[model samples]
Target: MGEHWIDVLPVFSDYWINGEVFTCQVDPTAQAQVSPWWQVPQRLIDQLLKTDPGPVIAQALQQLQETRADLYGRFSPALLEMKIRHLLVQSHGQREGLMARIVTTLESE
Candidate 1:
């Protein structure tokens, strides 16, 4: 189910960050074989964008899933954490230092 990254946004086509890695962060410039299937909801996005520190993944993802299963979908919190870590490591473009640390947080036991 995983393969090389796609560097170009297909014209007039639908794509998803969960299914593809955009190497440039905003666009594609290189390649990685995986994508994180979940993203922070708006509330969490705002929290994560803060400079000091982001919300704890162990706590946050669970809350998101439990409260809004219809939006984020049902996913394993631990696996989601691992997926995000893999994506960030493979294609973070050296600009997501805060996020790297944030995602590296331990998953819930």
Candidate 2:
């Protein structure tokens, strides 16, 4: 299947099964780009220093890109893609499941 981005989901992946194609579901929290994707720098510190957090966010993103590039250099595209897919799935699962676990524990207690 060719690569394509789903407008509703904001996910860029294609899935093929038994000659049918479908878009994968994305996490609801990640439905918006500004949610977990970007973090506000230390609020009190930034406010006290009167520094913008935008540059800090940009630097963090740059560092992540560099790390990803290094990893890609050391691995095949297929392997890297698989690793990224696995990580994304696990991250989303953890984010959703953690809340459920907390709620269940509180109810039990």
Q: Write the per-residue lDDT of candidate 1 for residues 1-109, one digit (tens) a residue.
A: 2333333333223455878634433425434435453444866555453432223444445554665554335356667666544544455322245343433442331
For candidate 2, write residues 1-109 as lDDT tens digits: 1443344233545666569888675565663555344334665654633344333334333443464444335545455444433433455423234333423333343
**Which residue pairs does candidate 2 place in steric collision?**
none
> What are the clash counts of all predictions, listed in order?
0, 0
Lowest-scoring 10 consecutive residues by lDDT in candidate 1? 4-13
C-alpha-based local distance difference test score of model 1: 0.45
lDDT of 2 at 30: 62
Query: Any idea what lDDT model 2 has?
Result: 0.44
